[model samples]
Each structure stands twice: as structure tokens, then as C-alpha cells.
Target chain A: MKKLLDIIVRIFRFIFFIFYYLKELVLSSLFIAYDIITPKDLMKPGIVEVPVDLKNDTAIIAFANLISMTPGSLSMDMNPEKTKIYIHAMYLHDKQEFVDKIKNELEKKIHQIFE
Target chain B: MIDWIAAFFLIAGSLFMLVAAIGVVKLSDVYMRMHAITKAASLGAILMLVAVSLLYVQWIVWIEALMVVVFVILTAPIASHMIAKAAHKTNMPKGPNYVMDELEGVDTDIPDKA
Candidate 1:
């Protein structure tokens, strides 16, 4: 019964993530489209290191890929130890805030689903 | 009505693709260009696939469209990462507007060009 409940919760979380990811995909695309349509140099590209607590390779790769697909962020590379990932962001105003947002929102959701 | 909706998605997808093309030409450097390609272009393609599936309304077509989307979402990021990594490792020229680089000295294999 406990296993069944766990499975049900996982399924619910997975469905929610799918909807969340779709919303992000469309929103990010529209934002980029707006940037591209205008004649402004509105980019502030920078690289930042984000630490991850993912236990396995598959989850790490998914996290990276999701970041790349999201707004203005790309996963450039990972360290040899796989503890940290390097990201190139198009618009980076606040470093610590960005890190905190990803940890709290994206990473936490991924952990709930995978871990 | 459904036909009109499908048409709208198709047109929107094509417009997004055009925007991606313009971005590739207008952006400052490779990194910025990739931001256009990986995000806008892939989303545009997915929208087009969705439009196509909507028009056909067959189970097989729906499955095929879903497969395409899955493949694209899986592969596009890895491909862009490879390019970005290679550019960084090879000391590719950065745009004039970059602010910070935290990856500097993080990798030992990057040839010391500076």
C-alpha cells in the first residue's frame, strides 16, 4: 500500500512536471522571439557554476538539457567530478539569485521526481 | 475551426523559425547565436509537429510526432553543449558584451592560448 501511494505520487509529480516544462518552453521561446525581433543589444552573457546534488548520470543529463531549453540559459560543460555544471546565460543580472532560483525551483522539482 | 487553429500554429511556427534565422545573423557571437538556435528553432519545429499532428488526427501520426519531439528535445541540448564546450576549449572569440566567465581555469585540458 505504501509502494502504491509512492507510485501514485510520482505519477502526479511527473504529470505536473510535463505541464510545467511545456509552459516554460513556450514562454522562453516567446521571450527570445521578442529579443530577436528588436534592434537592441540586450544580452548580458555570462558563465556561472551551479552545483548539483543529482545521484546518477541520467538525472544530471536531464537537468542540463532542461536548463539548455529554458530561457536564456545553456549548459556549457560539467566538471570532471560531476559536482558542478557550467552554464552560459544570455541575461545574468544577479548571480546568487539565479543560482538560488534554479536550486529551489528546477533542481528541487527534478529531485522530487527522480530521487 | 480546428483547421484554422492548425493553420495558426503552422504560421506561428514558421514565423518563429524565421526569427531564429534572423537571430543567427544578428546576434553578436556563437554563444548568442546558439541561444537562438537551440531554443527558438526547436520550439518552432515542435510547434510545426504539433500542427501537423493536429491536422492529421491519427494515432500513428500522433505517436510519430511525439517521437520526433522527444528526439529533438533530447538531442538539441547535447549538440549545443558540444559546440559550446568545443568553443570554450579552443578559446573561441567572445562577444564584446560578456560580463563574467566562471568556467575559466575549471578545466585543465583547455589549451592555454592566453
Candidate 2:
């Protein structure tokens, strides 16, 4: 009975995380479309390497995939050591802010879902 | 009310598709363009499928749309990831103003493929 409750809680958390991310994702994608559509010099595309704290392979892949799916970001490659993930961002204004989102928000949620 | 609802959805779906197409062309490079194509195209496809499913309101049609959404959600990321990796390996050029290559100096033993 305890195990069943635990499983239920995890599934609920996972679903909630998906919905939360989906809402943010859709809104941002819409905004990104505008940036692309404009004639203004609004985009600064760059490849950034973000250090990874999550050791699990599943978590790493999920994080990378989510980064790719998010507006204006694409996961390029993880180094041979898997210590850092290289990503291309349409707007490369702040590296620390993006990495913080990956570490604190995305990776934290992924850890909750998986382990 | 139903007519209005369906019309709204159809319009929304078409707008997304149009944006995706324009983005693919206007965006600078392969990876950036991939970001535009996969994200916009998949979202557009989902919205369009949902509008169609709502229109038909048939059991099989609804089920088929549900399946399509699931399939798209599952595969789009995988496709984007693989393509990015391949592009990286092939030394595909990024946009001119694009800055930084985090993978620049990292040595990798992964062999190039035929």
C-alpha cells in the first residue's frame, strides 16, 4: 500500500511537471517566432557549454532533449566525459541564467521524476 | 459556438504552420533552423491534428489523432538530437554572429561514420 501511494505520487509529480513545462514552452516558442520574423537584429546565436550536475544518463538525455525542444535553444553535444553539455541558443545574452535554469529547474524536476 | 471554436483552432493551427515554414527559411543555420523546424512544425502538427480530430469526432479518427500526437511527441526530440549530433560531427557552420563553442576544445575519441 505504501509503495502504491509512492508510485502514485511520483506519477502525479511527473504529469504536473510536464504540464508546467509545456505551458512555458508554448508561450516562449510563440515569442521566439516574433524574434525570428522581425527584420531587426534581435538574435545572437551561439554555442554554450553548460556544466552538468546530474550523473544519471536518463536525466542527462531528458535534460538535453528538453533544452532542444524549448524555444531558441538546441542541445548540441555532451563532451566525451559527459561533464558538460554544449547547446546552441538563438539569444546568447546570459550563460549563467540558462545554466541555472537547467540545473535548478529542469534537472531538479527530472531527478524527482526518475529517482 | 461549435463553428466558432473549430474556426479558431483551424486558424491557430495554420498560423503555427506558416510560422514554422518562414522560420526555417529565415533562420540562419542548420541547428538554429532545426530548432525552428522541429519545435514549430511539431507544435503546428499537433494543433492541426487536434482541430481535425475535433471536427470529425469519430472514434477511429480521434484515436488516430491521439496516436499521431503521441508518435510526434515521442519522435521529434529523438530526431532533433540525432541531427544535432551529426551536424556537430560534420563541423556544420553556425550563424555568422553566433558566438561560443563549448565543445570546441573537448577531445572526443568517437569515430566518424561513413
Per-residue alpha-carbon lDDT of candidate 2 for residues B1-114, written as tens digits (9 for 90 to 100): 666777887888788878888888887778877887777777778888878877886999999999998888667777887888887877877678766677665665566776
Query: How do the residues B25-105 of candidate 1 rate in per-residue lDDT, one tens digit apiece?
Result: 999889889989988899899999989999998999999999999888889889999999999988888998788999887
Model 1 lDDT tens row, A72-115? 89899987778888999888999998899888988888888888
Q: Each model's TM-score, in the order given?
A: 0.94, 0.89
CA lDDT scores, all candidates in order = 0.88, 0.77
The number of clashing residue pairs in model 1 is: 0
Cα distance off (Å), candidate 2, residue A57:
3.6
How high is the DockQ of candidate 2? 0.62
DockQ of each: 0.66, 0.62
Q: Which ten residues in a row have the lowest lDDT in candidate 2 chain A?
A: A20-29
- Listed for every candidate in order, the interface RMSD values in angstroms are 1.7, 1.8
Which sections of candidate 2 miss by over 4 Å? B109-114
> Positional deviation of B28 in candidate 2, in angstroms?
1.6
Q: Residue B114's C-alpha lDDT in candidate 2?
A: 65
